[model samples]
Target: MLARVAAAARVRPPERTGALLSATLVLSVGKGAFLATVMVYLLQIVGLTPLLATAGLTLWGAASAAVAVPTGLLVDRGRGRAVGSVAAVCAALLVPLSARVHTPWALLLVLCVAGGFDSAGNVVRRAMLAGAGGDSVKALAWARTVTNIGFALGALCSVRLLASRSPSAYETAYLLIGGGYLVMAACFATTSLGAGRRGSPSVRAPGVVGARSLRTGGALAAATGILTVHTTLLSTVLPLWVTRHASVPVSVLGWLVMLNSLIAVGGQLAVSRRAATREGALRCFRNSAVWTAGCCLLLGLVRFAPTGWQVVLLVAATIALTGGELLEAAGEWGLSAVLAAADEHGFYQSACVLGETTQGAAGPLLVAGLVTAAPVAGWIVLVAVLGAGRYIAGFTTPPPHKAIAIDS
Candidate 1:
């Protein structure tokens, strides 16, 4: 059954790949459902101040960041499936408890622990997806597409839930998220993943992967940093900038997010195929850099636009940013997958994820203070930062392994 599905989907290793995709879809829904309203839940149901809620979330992020490298190590040691399964179960059991926590410190501690497990689960899942087969890039692209669709649907649901503003609605969202994780765990449990599958190249590949890992990791990390600008802008920076500086209404933020997700869901697979080769990946990254820098500059000029024109400019900027993000995601997945040694993909990818982790941790702080204070100057600085990464990318070489070898 899965074989037929995989054949239709063009994913190899029919059964396992199908399972992974299904699991990814459900997992994404869960994540989107809860995250869309977590802040509201904390502020309204938990009765915490905005500062306290943000602080708790920040601490959770810190914990996730702290454990990422170690989790990668564990995944590489042939524990990817096990770790992900355990994480799913733990999340299922623990996530619902958030509703009962009243104080900030207690919420912080719960989230801190939950964050570590969540981070570990995510890294392991990515490692497993990368190891799916020769067309790991394609498989990941499919995963991303499904994730976006699921997230959009889930976010829509959360939006309706938010309208109610009832504690019961919030609890239901948490429980639904927990149930999603539980289902995802079962999916992982049934798959022949990690070191157990036949012809697992990672089992025969060299174990050390020392200096090679570092070189590849550093390059991918830079690429990740450049890509993160898209996320930081869409999620944190752009909304505030458009609302405060531009002539658009605050409601435009929701439309921008919806537009971004819609474009990704509709175009990710087609865009992903464009980065099938090393050169193609480089080109994608280059275009991403250019578009990102352009968007930043364009956004900087939004404030100077006529009242009616600001919305049009913001939409154009969003299109550029969205295109950059879509391309960057494809390029990142392709380059990182092809660059890492079969034996070292987990560790290498983890290092790459650190770029986003670091950016997520620091980007908000930078945007809140700088971008909020001076949107134009802040965006220009971002443009410079992304522009610098193009040179860094130039210095990066494809993995020493033949492209075919990496794919195999």
Candidate 2:
């Protein structure tokens, strides 16, 4: 009976892939709902002071970053599905608890725990995407496209909550977000694409094995970390730049953000196709550097432009930035998958996640400080930094013989 049950749990690759994407969609929507209304809910409904709220969020980021590598190490021990499902379930319970908490300490505790679970789930999911058969980059691209769509739909649904501005409305949104995480947990529980032990262990010591894996994958992780500054630039810096420096009305920021979403949703798959090979991935990185640098330059010049050209340049800059975003995502997915050892997906993925999470934790302060201190010079420095990072990333590419054979 146990053997039969185990066999039954082994889903086909196509079915597992579908489940993974469905899970991605669900998770994205939940995050979207939470992100769209979280600040207002915390400040107005819960009546927390801005400093407390910011501190709680900072703790959340810190917790997530702290747990990423450890969670990845656990996943490497043949527990990917179990670990991911458990993390999702924990998040499902913690999110609504967060909504109900009135005390500042409670809010901080709930967010810190939830953030750790969320980061663990993300690392396992990325590892699963790499292990999913046939064109990992393509699968990741589709998942990203679905994510954008889910976020858009979730945000649109939250409009009523934002409009009502009532405690009940915000609580209801949290309940729905929790429900989405429950569904995501179910998806992880049912899928087996990236689960289970690969084979017998190496004779080497565990510490040596882990250190070797990290050493092998460290360069790609650094490159990914450096590139993540673009996320900070787009989401935080650009909005502040437009509001403070450019003459455009604050209302224009919404359209610019929407344009970025539209471009990512439409172009990600096409861009990902170009990253199917090592050479192609490198090309994508180079292209991303060019597009991103151009975007910074254009946005920096917006203050000097006539009012008419300010909007025009803003739109153009957004388009360029979105293009860079698409290429960077595809290249990262390709390189991470190709460079990873067959049995060490979790280790390599966790390293990458550690890099990304560290950047996410520090990026806001770093980018905001630079941009606010010197708007024009900050943008110039960013352009140079991005260029330098891309150049360094090119040199980090392992020889073709070391590359994993990911099917196109």
Candidate 3:
């Protein structure tokens, strides 16, 4: 089965590839702009209290999570391109409205609906890539790299807006972001990528097959979810830990994040290539566990280090964490591709997204709370959990030859 799929896989034509990647870049730029400015806009311009802002964002996340599977189901039924384009357009229309919202209820409603559409757009994009049939992991890696570049550019643009401290500046940023989404919609609408297995006999009665695929994909997701904790640690816990405990200057945090992004942009493609096969993906997963564990240990010791060494250790730890991040991403993509039934890419992809969404939603508070309370012990607990997850992944992932047989 693996060989057969490989044989069937063909490189996308240059025009299609260009269109898809261009859309990804545009979407990511909008995402980056939104992330860089949304909180400040909500708090300063919109006059929401911190607690209300948090609650509204939480509701947005919930809406995204709630709609993921249903959007995926729609994609599986041959509507991926249509759904993606429409979702993008809807999000484009709704996001600018956020600039007009002053009340909590109005803000919450806008965010929730926009979040659902954004999440649906992402699900369709991933499903399209998965079903695209040729070196999909590498294709995704390129997309990731482009996304990072777009984000960096967008964030740079936001620095000017942030410095201006003008409400008009923020509103202008939102308008540009909405325009970006409109461009993304046009790209999706014009792309020629086929809807995989749509209307095929194999998918007609997807009930039993989808259930089985979901169970398998869900287990894969659960096993890998521990690795995703690193994301929260990178974005939220690390800066806080440094500020509160380590002697390292708070100013250094920005550089550390930049280093991670640089590494991801430079090395993600090479790492992804290594994980294009099942066995290679397993190895990547194992290596990621080791690197992440080392990172956790090094970070746990930061407070105890000499001031000069604190910076060194932090840099080293960031490098290690980035290594883990790169490998984990490649491994997950490879595993999902090999494990999913060819006709059920949307179902399996949805299961994977569900895991990521759940983790993203809950991880920050839990990780930040524990790490702040018991720094060393918290890191140790994380290492243990990650180790256990690695072991579970090894047990659950079918051997490559066996997976092929099952598919056959």
Q: How would you encode candidate 2's per-residue C-alpha lDDT over 1-408 as one tens digit per residue?
A: 999667645623333588888878987988988877887788888888998876777777788878877776666677788999999999999998888888878888999899899889888888888767678777777778888999988888878888898887777779889888888888878886763244525454332334435554676677777776767777788888888888889999999989999989878887888999877887786678788888889988998998889999999999999988898888887776776555566766776787677777778788788878998798889888888768767754755555333111
TM agreement with the true structure for every prediction: 0.89, 0.90, 0.91
Residue pairs with backbone atoms closer than 3 Å in model 2 (clashes): none
Query: How many residue pairs clash (N, CA or C atoms closer than 3 angstroms) in each of the candidate models, in the order given?
Result: 0, 0, 0
Sort by TM-score, best first: 3, 2, 1
Q: Write the per-residue lDDT of candidate 1 for residues 1-408, one digit (tens) a residue.
A: 989666657633324677878887887887888878888888888888889888777776777777776767666667677878898899887688776676778887887787777777777777778776677778778878888888887887787888988887777778878887888788767777662232336534443446545666777777676667788888877877777787677888888788888888778877888888878877787778888887787788888998688888888889999899888888888876776666666776676577677677667877567766766677777777888877677545654574336546
The reply for model 3, stretches above 4 Å from the true place, is 1-15, 200-208, 399-408
Worst 10 residues of 3 by lDDT: 7-16
Model 3 residue 41 distance off true place after TM-score fit, in angstroms: 1.5
Per-residue lDDT of 153 in model 3? 83
Q: Listing every candidate in turn, what is its Cα RMSD in Å to the true structure after a full C-alpha superposition? A: 4.5, 7.2, 5.1
Alpha-carbon runs more than 4 Å astray in model 1: 1-15, 195-207, 398-408
Q: Which window of ten consecutive residues has the lowest lDDT sum in model 2?
A: 203-212
For candidate 1, the per-residue lDDT at 143 reads: 78
Pairs of residues at least 3 apart in sequence or in different chains that clash in candidate 3: none
- Which residue pairs collide, candidate 1? none
